[model samples]
Target: MVVTRSETQTGAQTGAVQNSSEGWKQQPPYRTTEGDEGFEKKWTAHCHCGRVRYWLSRDGPLASKFCHCVDCQALHGAPFQWAAIFHKEDLRFESGAEGLAFYHAPDKSTTHRLPCKVSCAYCHAPIMDEGRNMVLMFPGIIKFSDAEHKKLFDPQCHIFYSQRVVDIHDGKPKWSKLDGKSELMKEVEREGSNTILGEPKNENMQD
Candidate 1:
């Protein structure tokens, strides 16, 4: 709802005016004047090229999940994509929305192994995806709160990395193995249980 300007234009992604003006515009009956409750305040984000954009509400703690399905690997061009989850109402858009694209891999049948993919309309940068329950937003797209938010709500778990190209053996972060070998596996594989660490672990968690 606020705008500022400097001197001359710079790069396509850097100098371009952010579409925040439109994305954060107040809804009617929801007065632009301060102190509107229905008007939810949200964090806005966009691709470097000013193509893909997103908005996130300031409600709820930041959370994450690592997806290792093969399609996820191809989509992110890595072992997995670490996504931060918030509610859908928490999201908003600004520009280049028409160019948003999607892809479904061969492993998909009833539904795509990878359900969704969002990219920059101009630069073609993959922005986010609908993995399980929460939309997997690329942390790099977020522009609000900067370092503080990054430190608090980054990726916490890695999912399906075994089928991914990059191996998760660094031990730099916590890791979990998949299940379904037997009934004992199911019993031992309860959520939040860990034998190696002598505690409960959430094995093969979704969302």
Candidate 2:
């Protein structure tokens, strides 16, 4: 998943919107979501400044997890990333359409990310991680008026927990890497924990 920046932006089911072209960017590196079955206005996520809005409609998410990858630590500038995966078709933009932005996600090992990150160009609030076949949205960004909606955003596990800078004693299962793709460890389990990278990591950081 990608972090965020301060540029700040939206779109429809697909195709086009207003006088804009195929992608938000006049050039490339910009692209744009579906569905009704088992779908309801499940959750709403907005940026830190509320310039960008994301409306998620789905019966449930594919997965919800806290990510402790180094990239997440640096990019999001958080102890870990709380991300919920959903079908692209199930996600849609609700505001800041004119100011959508993109940044290459940091993957030093490969340094390869095509449209790795998507956020509001205005407030730089990360909207989604448009990697793989689905989109990743911040569960924390979701606005829930009731306890039920809030519970839907709860994370099931922690990914890349080995790189965790802070300890989470919430009792969720932590994985050394991807679930099923790597070994599993409890939240209290770790060989040698690492302290937070540095202070003031969230300088100019978005929610």
Steric collisions counted per model = 9, 10
- The prediction achieving the highest TM-score against the true structure is 2
Put down candidate 1 lDDT per residue, 60-150, tens digits, no spaces.
3356756555555565676566677655445555532455554433322222223445565468787775433345577766775667756
Candidate 1 vs. true structure, TM-score: 0.55
* TM-scores of all candidate predictions against the true structure: 0.55, 0.68
Please give the TM-score that candidate 2 achieves against the real structure: 0.68
Report how far residue 96 has shifted in candidate 1, in Å: 8.5
Cα-based RMSD of candidate 2: 9.9
After aligning candidate 2 to the native by TM-score, how far in Å is the CA of 70 from where it should be?
A: 0.5
What candidate 2 gets wrong by more than 4 Å, as runs, is: 1-40, 95-97, 106-115, 186-207
Q: Clashing residue pairs in candidate 1, if any?
A: 55-92, 66-159, 192-200, 192-201, 192-202, 193-200, 193-201, 194-199, 194-200
What is the lDDT, from 0 to 100, of the residue 113 in candidate 2?
37
| Model 2 Cα lDDT, one tens digit per residue, 56-157 | 778568888888777677777777888888777676665324566665543322212343566777787777766545667787777878888678778898
